[model samples]
Structures are given as structure tokens and as C-alpha cells.
Target: MRIERLWIPEKPSVGKDIVQALIRTKRAKVLNAKSAATDGYFSLDTGDVVCPLFGHMLTMLPPAAYLTKEQNAGNYFEFLPLIPQPFKFEPKPDVDAKGKAHPPKRFNLIGELSKRAGQIVNACDIDREGQLIFDEMFLYWGLDPAGNRFLRAKITSKAETDLDRSVTALEKNGAEHWVRQRMAANARQVMDWLLGMNGSMAYQQLTGIKTMSVGRVQSPVLAMVVLRDLAIQTFKPQTYFVPVVTLADGTALRWEKRKDAAGTAGFDAAGRLIDKSLASGMVGAIKAGARGTVAVASTKVERESPPLPFSMGRLQATASKQHGLSVEQVTKAAQNLYEKHKAITYVGTDCEYLPSAMHADAGAVVAQLASVFPGKCAKADPGRKSRAFNDEKVDEHFAIIPTGLVPALSDAEYAERAVYETVVVRYLAQFYPAYEYEKTSLVVMYGPDEFRASARRDLVLGWRELEKPESTETEEAPANGPSRPLPKLEVGQQLAATGVSLETGQTKPPSRYDEASLMEDMISAYKFAKTERDRELLQETQGIGTSRTRGPILQNLLKRGFLLSTKKGKRHEITSTPFGKETIGRLPPWLTDVATTAKWELMLSAIALGEAEMQSVIESQIQYVKTVIERARMQVSPRQSAANEKGAGAAKKAA
Candidate 1:
């Protein structure tokens, strides 16, 4: 008999859970008693089959796949550019020691099952990439997506409850929403391939280099580090002075000249006091025992809400910053938490907001988390929903949060423990009340200048009681020193200066980019946009690359020898290598322009939203690839010139 239903998930692990969930719910009975959970698909007595597809079983064909034998043998420069009218794809092949190619067994299995199943359900991830993964397989197997037999099961989490909900709420596979998203994802994959293949080949052919790698996002990311390194290398410092007075009560106050027509300015435009004589005079005037009056005093109460739960990028950045973990380490740990333990939601999501509906599940999730982190989850109030519970901001997946499944882990797994606790504590903070504090601002009138001071006092230890801020973070103190708590005083209260001094300092260059800072910058690349339109577009799109690709982009650069990562204490400082800088210098401006790539991202987003046509975007990228190839052909290789010079010198020496 034809199978009643066939479910295809993104991987074997997800398929195993789906089978278990169906069995536990009594929705289906297992048919194969001897098959291990990890090895084979689950056949059910109800004629339903559960199978899984390895991530991206198929990929775009290489240039050789399109070019004729003669054209392939010709110089890469002569062919100029290879733009396949309609790109073709095939299953990624594996070669054995005997050099025979074999298609992945999983890929063949899916093809075989699609013939027998009456309906094929795409139970892959809920994102664009996931759509593309399933769609590609469907196309390769000659299965029609628009047919009524195909469906989409949007699973957000692997938890049994979520899986059942998703299965029961399946939608048509060829709906406009799914089509548009798949189209957009396909555009990104093809464009990246076009640029990487043609652009890199052009450079290699012209420069006589054996290997060169470039991409739409990778090149621009390399430029960010190279340009930052250049700025630091070329920066010039200017010396300045900062004057401050210490009151008898040990409060430090910074000196500021009054902004009046009759008063002379004592500081530079950058807020540095460059007038050495003025600084010295102020120190002499406000000597020990000199008196001053409080010209102004005020205190205001402020409330700081708890931080939102971790988005994947935010979690990676925080883990890198706090625990000195690499992006790969944190990402791997997070994947294990989601896939192996089923303890967290999707880990590739960039959104930090949760569905309002999920707010009701907070109590159950917290109860489960309490089993592992009893003390940390003690005071959480699941009833209170913070701003993070806004439904409008949620997309394919919600922020990373506990799935109410207790993770089976030991203390020895430091990386996994660190990642899980970081996510759990962040989730718990949402249930706590806002932190409240009273900030006091004071201004004292000295002989010819004004001194300012501020201090903060805790009024309500709410969320802060759960987790204290990282000690590495601190406020910038005044030139004299840290400010002390202020006593209650009237505006006319008098104070004596117990000491005064001026400190000499110089301007410092911007700090180098580390993994954490670079990741943050990648997410906020809109700030570097050159045009208002591009900035607005980048804002809507949220960055050049998706959350899943940014970390790999950085790692790929390091692997390709384009960037260097050096250990500075616990942090790895990133710097561009000489070859990296040379690559950027030789590339056209548009290639390294972050704004341009952001604009591309905006285009892709439009395609995904059904606002733009995919063909138009792909055509534009084809033109861009052609232009890059032509430009590369026009340039002479420095290596070629050096080789010529060496040959001439050798000839002269022989004569």
C-alpha cells in the first residue's frame, strides 16, 4: 500500500525525535523492531514513514559542468566570465581512494521513498536555508513542489509538544510564502557562487597566484580588519591635561570652565584639556583647604530592565567576551544544547524576541531549569512578561530559551555548561523586576571654574539580585579618581578641597578587533554604510550575512591565510595578513564596500518578502561579476613584474 505520510527532517537526529514523539503520543506504532534509532528510518504500522536528509545534499555545479572541454582547457582569462543562463545542481559526490564517485546514500534514499509516499512533508528547519535544502532535493528527485501531495511542517523546536503542534499545523508546500523564501535563498547561493568562482579565478589567472579565495561577504569582512589596522598604524597622538579636585569627603570632581561670553575655553574640541597653564593654575587655586559652594544638586531615579534572552549572535559574542570562548566553541556547544539535549530552541536565529504565546510556557521551562540550576532559578516570576515577549518581532524562530527539557550534562563539560548556564540565566532574568537606582548629579563652584561629580545608589535590587554585571565592565571615572557617595546637601552647602592635581595623558587609537567585537560590528554593519538609502536598507536587512554564516566567514578567512588570530591573554586579536591587505588593495572599491553588500542583502530580503523578482537580482549580480572580471584582467600582477626584474638581473650578472 502507498504510504499515508512521509516526513523528511533536516537531519537524522531530528527524525529520531519525531519518531519517538509519534510513538509516545500513540499516534503511530513502530514497524521495525531491530533497527537502531540512529541508523534507519522509522516505519510505522499506520503506513507513515519518518526519514531525514543530511544538510544540503546537493550543491551548484562548478564551472566545468557548464563549459565545453576545449573552453575548459583554454586560459581562464580568455573565457573571461562564466555565467550559466540557468544554473544546474547535482548531489554532492564522494570520491573513494580508487577515484570513483558515489552519491550520498541518504540522497538516494530520499529519492526512492518519494516514489512510494502519497504525501511528502518538508519537516526541515523553519528558515529560508531550510526551505532551500528541501526544495533542492525535491527538484533533483523530479518531484513537483506545487503538487497537492507536498506539504510543509514548520517545526520551531524539537520538543515533543512543539513537534506535535507543527505536524498538526502543516501548510501547503508551494504556497507563495515558501516559494518566495526559497527563491531568495537560491539567489544568495547562486550569487555567492558566481562571485567566488569568477572573481577568484580572474585574480589567480592575472596575478599568477596558485590559490586565491574571495566571496561577497568574505572580502568585505577582510577589509574591515585591514582598514582598522591601517588606521591604528597611521594614528598620531596629542598630549592633553585633565584637572580635578578631591574634596574633604573624598569625592572626586572634574573641572569645567563656565560656557559664558567672558570666559576663555580651557579644553580642546575632543573634550581634552590642552591648556597646561590653565590646568596648573586651577590646581594652585584649588589647593588643600580651599572652599567651594555647591551650585547645583539633583537626584533622579532610573529603572533598568533585565537583558533579553540570547539570540545566537548575542550568545556567541557574550560567551566569547565572558568565558574567553571562541565563536566555533560557543556555536558548537549551542548546537549540542539544541540537537543533542533538546534543551534549547533554534540556535541560528538572529531575533531576540519571543512569541507572546510562549510567555505562558515560562513557568514550565523554569521549573525544568530549576532541576539543574536550583539557586539561579529560585526567584523567577513566570507571570511577569517583559518587553521581549512581543510577538511582532518574532520570525522563523524565537530567541534561544529553555525548551523545558533538562540537559543531561556533567561539570566536566565546561564549554557546554558555560553556554547552557549563560542562556538559562539570561532567560530567567526576563521574569525578574527592573533594577532601580538613584543617580545623583552635583556641580560645585570653585574660584574660576566648575567641578562636576556623579554617583549611583541602588534603590531596588531586582534583576541585579539574580546576576551581577560582569566585573570587566566599569564606568569611566573623573580625572582625579572614582567618585564617592554624596551626603544629603542643600545647593548652598560649602565644601573644602583636600587636594588638587592635573594629570597628563594622550589620545589613544581605536582598539583592535577581536572575535566578539568583529561579530558585533558585522551585525551592525549598517553604521558603516555610505549612503542614507543603503543605511536604511541595511537596517531592514540587519547585516551583510545571516547569523549562521558570519562565524564561518571569519573562520574561513583564517583558514585561507588571509587573516591572523593571535592570543592576547584569553582573547584572540584579529589582524589582516600581508596577503590579506594586498588582496583588498588590489580589489575594486565596490568589492570591499560593506554598503554595497548590505544593499545586496536588502535586495535578497525584498525577494524573500515577494516585493522584488529573483531574476532581476540575479541578473544584476551577473553584470557585477562581469565587471569584476574585466577589471581584474586589466591589472598587471606584481609577481610577474618581480619575476621579470629578477630575470634581467640574472642576464646582466652572466654577461
Candidate 2:
């Protein structure tokens, strides 16, 4: 029963894979193979056991667990804020059909194993959440998390080579890096718990909204939706006009203002004239046989580098735009490709760069991809290093790439195929040359007015040829102009106007935040920051939530009826419900301001980086929660205030 070393991966399947890899590398042998799945452990010949955690084995204890006896018997508002000194934790429980709660089945097994093992290795995922998982588990099982017996196996993937190397190089559990991660995760969890518990209760007490729930991230996300919906509801369009002259070749050139007349004709910032008379006069004169002389301003070659590989957020946004897939759908498909098919590397990573050492392996992977995508992979020079291969840019995991596993997927797997093919194409795109094009900028003079036109001509379809979707034969042209090459013209060639007309258009309102755009905003939240420091912090933290948690946060809003989503063609148009609007209006500014949340997020990240103390951050949040709750309690409705006074009197009598 005395196991020398215990290995704990994040999932059961991962544990099995790690065990098999150890055996394949002749580093470990099965002592009891049957016990692997039946129980949660696989005893090894090297006197180590491989057992896995089911995501998180422990969760923060609810605030009710720390309520005083008097507070339980009386008005709960009296216990305005419940701050756990050390933050007690309990095993995340499971409920049966009969509604009886019990610890997870493997909880006892892991707990017993922890007690008997000489050394326990935290072989979880290599992320903050993973470290928190092991930290909470050890604390719940009454073991010292910082003890010398505890070690760490920083595993990023389930591949045999990665697992072998990770297991071979076990790190000290109490190392500063690992400890700081634990501290950061702990602070984040504690902050969320405090906010949800205290803020929700305070909101309920003040507004009597029984269905309301507040969170650190979700409230601000809800505020964003509500504000956008209001903006769209209240938006008023202003009409503008422009004189467009049509040439014999059907190229319509819009009138451009000269430097002296830039702001003379009631022109807007975008140079659209609000004066209908001026536009009409220009059109009338141009249509009356006005001859224009061509003034070729510039003609030059322009090269656009290929897009870098996909991060999860980038992949989600692209999939939503190109394939009409939601972020949730793309996430699921990507996860399937990573976990089920083993076709790609880790899917939960935010990093989009690979280690420089991975170039040789990537070349081999590209060679394998040629079998499946011959045309796309034909010119893929994987040996040529792209900007994505910098080692310094890599985070906990590298950008997702094919593991060289050509999966034989069925046609029914639409999402999977979409995700896999996109990833494959994007990865190969970096290996090809930049897309080169000839851009011609022209200015035509008609009497006293000037018109501008531009055209793009393809010079070399380097990566663009390979980047096109399989379903499309031709590339989609840009919106403003045609993709055709412009006709050759001299600087002073005279051209007769075929026709001229005034085009009237109205300004459009901002689009609604669908799941894709919302996710994009969440990643680029620095734009909404109130202060420059918050903006910088948001940029570093990649907006509000991590890629792994953003999808769920959005889904939770839908589940809670805070935001209503409607299917408009292929995309979902998201709008805030009236109740959601009311909830946000009643919530404090700090809870709804993204800049405030971004500051806290940065502090949490700093804790993980060992730049800030965890206890100080947690202490600050505790005081913040207390003040927020007190403010809410004071801002209660008159009726609710009377009811609260009545309840307090009743409680005092009982006490």
C-alpha cells in the first residue's frame, strides 16, 4: 500500500495515456492493469501509481458554511460580508437521482492514496486552474500543499513524447512558479466567490429581484450587451450624399474634396457631404459633358504577409465569420479534434507561437499533411521559420498544430472537418510566401472637382491560392472596388464622363454583439478600459476571461436569461432582456465597469508572476466586497427598507 510516487493527471483518459506512454518508453510497467479504469489508479513497476483528477477535485466552500449561528437564525444581511480567513474547501460533490449528495466516487480513492504515498506528484494540466486543482485537493485531504513530498509534472499534452519528457523532469511542488500560480488561482476563486455570494444577496435584498445573480465577469459582460442594445434602440441615422461619376468602362469614381474645400460643403469626418444641394449641383455639372483628365498618383507593389496560426480566440472568431459556427460549436469541435482524434495539439491554449525547436517536427507534420491536402501543402516550406516560431512568445502551451495524425473523419462531422481543415490551412499558410499585389491609386480632375479611384491587381497568389476554402472557386472581391486590374492611363489623358448621379445613403448603427463578436470584444476589452493603466493591463491579460472560461461565461448568461439570443440567418443576434437591463441598472458602477474588473485581473496575474502579494490582493477584495454590499444595503427601495426593518425586528425578538 506504500506507493513511492503518485502521479495525478487532470483527467482519467490522460492518466491512462501517460501510463501507456511510460510503458512504451520502458520506464514503467503495469503492476495491476485491471485497476486502471475500474478504480482510478494504475500501479507501475517503478513503484509509482498513475491516478488522475476529474478536472477539479475540490471547490470553495459556500458562504453559508461560514455563517454564524445567530446570523443563520436571524437576518442574513447582518452578516453583510462573509470572508473566510484561509478559505476552507470541500470535495466537489455529486447528486444522485434521489437528490442525495456525496463526494465524487474516486475522491475517497485519491484521498486514501494521498495518505499512503511517500510522495505525491501534481501531474495536472500546466495552467493556473490545474495548479489550483491540486492545491485544493491536497488542502482538502489534510495534507500540506507546500510539503517536500509533493512534486509537479507539468504536462501540456497527452502525446507520448511530451508525457515521457514531462514525467521524467518532475519539478518541486513548492517552487516559486508553481506556488505563485496556486496563489493567483486561489485569489481569483476567492474574489469570484465573494462577489457572487455578497453581491447577489445584496442585490436580492435591495431590489427584491429573486432571480438575480451577480458575478465578477458576467455582470460586466451583461452590461456590455445592455448598453449596446440601448445604443441600437436609440440610434438615429443621418443621410449624406456624394456625387459619383461613371466612366465608359463602368468605373464609378466618387468626388473627393480638395484641401481648400475639405470642410466647406458640410462634410463629415468621413468626407461625406450632408449638403444635398452641393452634391446635386456637382452631379448636374458633371453629367453636362464634363471632360476629366486622368492624374495617376501612385502605382506600386504591396505584399501582405500570411496570417499567423490560430489562437483559440482567433480561431473562434474566424470560424464564426467564415463557417457560420458559434464560439461554443467551434470550441467543442476543436476539443474533439484535440482530445478524441488527437489530430491537434492542446486546444485550451491562448498562445499562438511555437518553440524554435519544433521546426523539424513541424516539417515532418507538413510532409504528412501533403497526403491529405496535396495542393495546399505542395509549396509549404515548413523548414522556413515564420514569426510564429519564436520560443519567447510561447506561454503554458504552444499554438495548436496538427500532431501529424491524419484522421479518417466521416462526412457527418461537419464542425470537426471545418475546424480541422481551417487549422491545417492556417498552419500551412505560414510556410508559404507572402501574397503580392499591384495597387494603383488614381486621381481624376473634372473641371474644378476631383475624383479618386483605386484598383488591385494580383501579382503573385502565393499563400492566397492555398488559403481559399475548398467550397469556393474564386476569391471574394473587396467591398469598395473591383479586383480587376485598372486600364493603363497617362497623367493627363482626357476622359469623357458617361453619366453622373448623386448617391444618397444613411449612416448605420453599431452591430449587435453575437457570440463571436462578443468573444472578440472580451479579448480586446482594453478598448473599454477607463484608464490607461487598465488598458495596458487588459492588453496583457487578454481581456476579461481566459479562453478556457469565456465560452462558459457567455453560455451562463444565456442559461440565466440575462441575455436573449435570436438566430438571424446564420448568425445569432444577441440582445439584453428587460430584466437584464434592470439588473445592470441597479448594480454598482464598479461591478459593471470593465476597467475595474481588468484592474483586478491584472493584480491576479501579477500574483501569479510573483510581482504582487496574494494576501494583499485578497484582503483588498474582502474590503471591497464589504463596502459594495454596504452601499447596496443603503440604496434599497423604500418598501424593501421597511421589509428589512420588519425582518430585523422579528429576528431581534427571536434572539
- Candidate 1 regions exceeding 4 Å error are 33-40, 68-81, 96-100, 232-238, 246-250, 255-271, 274-297, 443-451, 470-483, 486-500, 531-541, 566-569, 630-655
lDDT by candidate, in order shown? 0.82, 0.80
Which residue runs does candidate 2 get wrong by more than 4 Å?
Answer: 69-77, 103-105, 245-251, 255-272, 281-296, 443-451, 468-500, 530-537, 566-568, 588-590, 630-634, 637-639, 651-655
CA error at residue 615 for candidate 2, angstroms: 2.9
Q: Per-residue lDDT tens digits of candidate 1, residues 1-655?
A: 4778889999888888778877766567888757845545778887779988878889888888887665554457667688887888888876789999887777777788888999998988877888999998877777677579999988778787887777778899899999888999999999999999998877766665647666899989999999999999999887877677877677778766544513236666655567788778767877745688998888889898998888788888888877788888888999898988888888878788999999889999999889888987888999999999998887667899889887788877788888888888899999989999878878888865678888877788888987786543255343433245765668998988778888788989989998888887777789888878767767866677877888899899999889998878868789999999888887777778887887888899889888999999999999999999888766856775466456545655555
Give one clash count per candidate, in the order shown: 0, 0
Task: Please provide TM-scores, in order, for all candidate models, with all chains considered together.
Answer: 0.86, 0.88
- Best lDDT goes to which candidate? 1
Candidate 2 lDDT, 1-655, residue by residue in tens = 7898888888877787778877877666797887666766899888788888789777777776887555654555777877777777777787799999986877778888877889988987777888888888777766778799999887665555666787788889899899998999888998899888888877876776767788999998999999998889999887988788887777777877645565565777666677888778778777777788997657889887777787788788778766778788999998888777778888777778888888878778898888899988888888777788888887567888887877778999988999999899989988988889878877798776778777778788878877763332254343247465455678999988898888888999888988778887777779898777767767876677776888899889998888887777778678898888999988877778876787788898889888999989988998989988888877876787778778767867777
| Shift in Å, residue 146, candidate 2 | 4.0
**Model 2 vs. true fold: TM:** 0.88
Query: Top model by TM-score, which number?
Result: 2
